[model samples]
Target chain A: MEKEISDPTLTVSGQRGPASHERRIQIIKSAHEHFLQYGYKKTSVADLAKAIGVSSAYIYRFFESKQAIGEAICSVVLGKFVVALHELASSDMSASNRLRKLYITLLDMSLEMFFNERKLHDITIAAVEERWCTTTQYHQTKYEVITKIIQDGRASGEFERKTPLDEVVMAIVETLYPFSHPILLQHPILLEQSEPEVLHQRAIAVSNLVLRSLAP
Target chain B: MEKEISDPTLTVSGQRGPASHERRIQIIKSAHEHFLQYGYKKTSVADLAKAIGVSSAYIYRFFESKQAIGEAICSVVLGKFVVALHELASSDMSASNRLRKLYITLLDMSLEMFFNERKLHDITIAAVEERWCTTTQYHQTKYEVITKIIQDGRASGEFERKTPLDEVVMAIVETLYPFSHPILLQHPILLEQSEPEVLHQRAIAVSNLVLRSLAP
Candidate 1:
C-alpha cells in the first residue's frame, strides 16, 4: 500500500520551501518526545502544537493527523531497523549463519525497544494495530531483504530449491512471529518467560529448525 | 503452572451443599452474560453480585477475584476447544492429514471467535495479555495433543525420528503461531487479510512445509 503521507504543504502544486522541511522535522521531534512521555494515544495534536509554539493549523500544514505524525516517527525507527537488516543480509557470512543472525537481530532490536524505549514501543504497537503505512512499508522492505538472503542461499546450494519461494518466506515469518511481531513480543506470558539467556537459547533453537527445513 | 482456581467452597474440608454448587453455576452464567455485553474489564464483581442478588462476600466464596470469574468462563470455552482437538487428533486419518486439519481448525475457531463472538474475543485477548491460567492451561493441553500426533507419525515411520521430539513439537507450535495465537490473530492488518479462503491456502502451505521437513 502507498504511504498515506498527505502533507499539502509538500505537494507538487503547493511546493513548500526549505523552511517547511525544517518545520516538519521540528514537529516530528516535539511529537516524538511528547508521545514518549505521555503515550501516543494520550498526547493530542493540539498539545504538540502548544509545545512547539505553533497553531494547530500550522502543524496541519506539515502533517495531516496525529496518526500521520506517528507514521513519520515510526518510519524513522522502522526504517533504521530495515537498513540494519539489509546490511546483515548482505554481509559476508554463510547464508545459514546470516539467517541465524537476522532472526536474533530482530529479537534483540524489538526487545531493546520494549525495555529501554518503552513509550516508543507503545507507539509501535499502535502503528501495528492501526495498520500505519510505515509499519506495512517497513514489512515490505524487510521481506525483500529476507527474499534476497533466501535466493542467495539457494544460488549457493545452501538451501533446498524445490519449495516455492513465497511459501518458504511466509513460513519463516510466521515461525518467527513470537519474536519479531511487536504485539506477540509484548504478550505478558511471553514477557515473563523472556530472560535474555532463555530468549537467546530459544532463538537459536528456532533458527536451527528453520535452517534444517531449508537444508539442501 | 497449576491452574489458579481458588474456590473455598469447593474444597474437601469445606465441602459445600448442592445449593452452593447451583449458586456457583448461577454466578458464572450471570458473569458470562454481563462480560459478553459490557466486556470483561468493564464489569465489576459488585455489579455481578447485584445481578445475581447475592452479597459480594458470597461471590468471593466461589471465586477469588474478577479475573477468577473470567477464568471460569474461559475454561468453559477453551475446554470445549481442547476436547474437540483431542477428538480430531485421535481420528482415523493419516498423521500428516490430521496435522493439517488441526492447523486449519485452529484458524477457523479463532476467526469464528473474532468475527462472531467479538465481545467474547476481547475477553480472550485480555486473558492472554494478563496470563490467565485458563489461557496457559489451554495451550498446555493443545501442545500435548500436537505432541501425540507427532509421536504417532514417528511410530508409523511417516516422520523422521532423528529430531528430538520436544524440538519438533516446539518448531511446529511456533510455526503455527499466526493461526493459533489470539494476539496475532486479532491484529487489524492480519484480520483485514484473513479471508477464509486465503487463510486456508496459507495454512495448507505451512503444513506442507512442515511435513516435508519431517519426512524421513
Candidate 2:
C-alpha cells in the first residue's frame, strides 16, 4: 500500500497519433485473443504480431515486453471488477447489505474466471505470481472501496465505531482473501468442488461474520 | 471433509522386519534431507537412491512414487503444526484467547517456513498444488480443532450459539486463509513486506474481528 501503483491501461505508450493509438489498441485486442486461444504463456509476441500482420519489433513499439502487454490486458479485465466494486459501494442500500453483496459479487467474478475464463485465469495467476502493478492497484482500489463502505456504515450508525478503521479494514480484507486471491481460489481443494451455489453460501457466511463484527 | 484422510506417516509401508523398518526410516530421512538441500522436484528418486546407496526400485518398494515420498514428508512436516493446534485447542485458556493464539501461531509457523525453510516452503507449494492427501488431512485436522474450540467457547458462554456451527467454522477457516494457505503467504506482495511483527499484528487484528463475531 506504500507504493504508488500506476494504471497500466492509461500508460499504453502509443499515443503518437490517432493512427498509432488505433494500432496499439488493435495490437492489444489481437494479443488478448491470442492469449485466450493459446494461453498467456504459450502465446508469444511473435504470435501476436503475426496474427496482427505486424512484426514483433512493431509489437514492442507498443508494449515494452510480453509481460507489459499482459499487464495492459489484466488492467482492462480487472478494471471491470474494480468498477463493479465501486458501483456496489456507492449503491443505494444499507452499508451492511452492500458489504454482503460486494463479497458475493467478488466471489461470483472469481468463480467466473476460474470456470468460464480459464485462459484469463491463467493470465491472472501469472499476473499475481509476477506481482504485476495492475494486481497491486486492484487490491489497493479494493481496500479503498471497503474502507469507504465501513466509513459509510459508521456514519449511518449501522456499524461499531470503537474498532480502529484500519484494523477493521485489514480484518475484512484478510477474511476475503480466499475468495479474492486467485491462487487460493484455484487451489485443488476449492477448484475441485466449488459449485457456485456452495461458494455463494460460503461467501454469505463469511460476510455475516464481518457484519457481526461491525455491528454497533 | 467427506473423504477419509489416512495418515501418510502412519502408513509408511515396509513394516516387515525391524531392519526393514530401520531401512525405510533411513530412506525417508535421506530423502527429507535431500529435498531440503536440493528441493523436492529437483531431487529425483534415483538421486535419493544414489544418496542412500540403494536402488530406485528399493526406494519404490516403500513408496509408490516421488510424489508419494513428498506426501509422506509433508505429512510429517504438517503433522507437527497439527499437533500444536490440537494442544492449543485443548488448553485450559479461555476459548476466545485460544482461538486468537491459534491463528497467531498459524501465522508464525507459516512465516517460519517461508522465511527460514525456503525449500520446505517449495515442497509445500507442490503439495498444495498437487492436492496431496497430506495437505487435505492437514486442513481437515485444522478444521476439527477450530470446531472444537468454537464448541468450547459456546458452551462456556463466551460465544454466541445462534449461528450454525458449520457456518461459523467455515467462516473462521476462510478468515484465516491468508495466514494458513502457504501459496497466499508466499505471494510476492506478502512475502516482500511480511516482517513477523507486522504479520503478528495483522493476525491479532483479524482474530479480534473473529472473536467479536463469536461474542455472546
Writing each residue's lDDT as its tens digit, candidate 1 over B1-216 gives 112222222111222335349888888899998888888888888998988899999988888788877777777777767777777777889888898888898898878877766678767877877777676667776777778888888888888888888888877877788887877886656788668788777788778778887888
- lDDT per residue for candidate 2 within A118-164, as digits (tens), equals 77767888877777877877888788788888888898899999999
Encode model 2's per-residue lDDT on B1-216: one tens digit a residue.
Answer: 222223323233222334348787788788888888998978788999999999998887778788877777777778878778767867889989999998888988888767776778778888777778677777787788888888888888999999999999988888888787787886655677567777778889899999999878
Candidate achieving the largest TM-score: 2
**Candidate 2: RMSD to truth:** 4.2
Instruction: Give the least accurate 10-residue stretch of model 2 chain A, judged by summed lDDT.
Output: A1-10
Interface RMSD of 2: 1.8
The 10-residue segment with the lowest total lDDT in model 1 chain A: A6-15
Candidate 1 lDDT over A110-213, as tens digits, reads 88777876788678888777777677766766677678778889988999999999988877766677787888886546777668776776777778778887
Pairs with steric clashes in candidate 1 = none
